[model samples]
Target: MTTSFIARTTLAVAAFGALALAGTAALAGDQDFALLNATGYEIGELYVAPAQSSDWQEDVLGQDVLSDGQQANIKFSRDEDTCAWDLKVVYSEDNSSAEWSNVNLCELSAVTIKYDADSGETSAYGQ
Candidate 1:
């Protein structure tokens, strides 16, 4: 009887452990991608659109300005836009980062940004 009880207890613990690990994996898989800004600009607006689409999705206002060393995490979804292609942004001193779905945004070949201080010079970067 003692051996049987011990075996049952061990099995129960193992089952619980498996459930916990499965839950963690599910949560991780659902996570959305985010853009990290370490510059001094306070983001005013953010936009995202597919590479093949001409329409851009305007993210809601109110974002944390990425200070020289601060970071913010955003959530995104493809259903929020019309094109459902990729991601883009138009920010100012007030807005900071835009979070969107469509993993292709992270894989952009180049990103262009127009800065006010640089007389509207467009800066580009690769993923």
Candidate 2:
């Protein structure tokens, strides 16, 4: 084989590899997810953080409120290797909050906030 032919083939292979990596990155956050508010009050703050992170990131709501019985899209840049995440929501009425730890964002697409009116307790589940 000619040297020129081998060089051209190597360049083509490299280009193909770069394109494959780009395609994989574009698939991040492909599946849609939402948060359902069932706390019997408005949610004043919503936060999502990686399970390994020590501090919570910014509030996703940003002055918006998720009213009772309302569902809002929870858009995030999902890491392919990490599926666990933490979610927190604070109520507008009394500043009471609920949190979920090590919630798997990969398998679960929706998170519902559950409240017990009788016990005055709040919790969350992923589905």
Candidate 3:
């Protein structure tokens, strides 16, 4: 009888552990975001902000991540600039990294750092 009880207890603990691991995996899946950039340019810096707020939350600069042919939907807004644009990016496959210094994407609603893409390309709404 004692051996049976021990076996049951072990099985119950194993089941609980499995459940915990499954829950952890689910949470981890939800935590990732897509990191998109322009076609030619790699990601030099990234910035993010809350949904309703104007202040931008800057990510670590000079840390290149997005490569060519890769896309991600990172968080951004036009709160800093007067223009209200939707910031979208696409990394070009031709470039190794983007020019972080000269590119001020504040005016673009959706900025695409293309390898051969022009710097002065504007969106419809001046974003």
Model 1 steric clash pairs: 42-93, 43-94, 43-95, 43-96, 44-92, 44-95, 47-88, 48-88, 50-85, 50-86
Q: Which lDDT tens digits does candidate 1 get at residues 1-127?
A: 1233222222112222222221112122132434444333545555554444556656633454434334444454444322123444434542333333333332333232323333322222323
Q: How high is the CA lDDT of each candidate model?
A: 0.36, 0.63, 0.31
- Give me candidate 3's TM-score against the actual structure: 0.31
Best to worst by lDDT, what's the order?
2, 1, 3
Candidate 2: TM-score? 0.71
Best by lDDT: 2
Score residue 7 of candidate 2 by CA lDDT. Answer: 30
lDDT of 3 at 17: 24
In model 2, pairs of residues that clash are none
| Predicted structure 1, TM vs. truth | 0.39
